[model samples]
Target: MARLGIVALLAAFGLILTATSSPAASTLRAAAAEKNIVIGTAVATGPLAGETAYRTTVAREFNSLTAENAMKWDTVEPSPNSFNWSGGDAVVNFAAANGQRVYGHTLVWHSQAPSWVQNLSAADLLPAMRNHITKVMQHYSTVDS
Candidate 1:
C-alpha cells in the first residue's frame, strides 16, 4: 500500500515535471499556494537537517513538514518520567528555517506506546495520557508564542 502511494506520487511528479519548463517551476508548494491549501511531506529530521539534497527538495517543494516518527509516543517518551525533545525539536527547527509550517504527526497512539503505558490499568490511562500531552505541548509552547 505504501509502495503504491510512492509510485503514484512519482507518477504525478513526473507529469508535473514534464508540464513545467524547469524543476523550479514545478513545486508542489507553488501549485498548492494557488489553491490555498498547504502541500506537505513527512520527513525524517536527520535527513531534512543534514542532507543537502533532501533539505533543498523539502524546502522548495513543500510549505509544511511533519516528523515521520520523532513525535511518536515511544520516541518522545521512552520511560515513565523522562521525555526526549531533541528529535522533535530538530524537525521543528528545520521547518522554521525553511519557512515551512510544522504539523504535529500525532499526540498519542496505541501503537509505538511505551512499556509503562502498556502496563497501566484502564483507570489510570487517561490521566497518564493527559499528562504526556500536557508536557509535550508545554515543551513546545514557544513555537506558538
Candidate 2:
C-alpha cells in the first residue's frame, strides 16, 4: 500500500512537472505512459540442442517475450566467421508470429562471452561487437523498436 502511494505521488509529480516543463512535455508524458510491457522467458530448460520445443512453449504462454540469457555477444558471434542466430531468431520469430514484442538481451556486457572475444584487441573488438549487434538487430528489427 505504501509503495502504491509512493508510486501514485511520483506519477502526480510527473504530471505537474510535465505541465511546467518544455514544449515536448506532452510527447514525453505520453511516452512515459506507454508501458514497455515485456514478458520475459528463459531458455534454461528443455532440449539442449536449441530453442525448438521450449521456444514454442514460451510463445504459447505469453504475448510478448524477452528471452532471458538467450541472446549474448559470444554465442551470436563466436569466432570471426561463426555466427549463431538460431536461438535468438526462434524467440523473435515466435514473438512476431504471436503478435508479441521482443527485446535484444544486450550490447555490452561480460560473463556470456566467447574466449576469442575475450582475447580480442581493441581495434578488432569494436568491429566484432558491432557485427554482433547488426546481425541480431537485423534478425529482430522487423517489429519496430
Top-TM-score candidate index: 1
In every candidate, how many clashes are there?
0, 0
Candidate with top lDDT is 1
TM-score of each: 0.81, 0.57
lDDT of 2 by residue, 82-123 (tens): 877777776666667767666566655788777888878999
Candidate 2 residue spans exceeding 4 A from truth: 1-39, 43-57, 143-145
The lDDT values for all models are 0.77, 0.58
lDDT of 1 at 17: 74
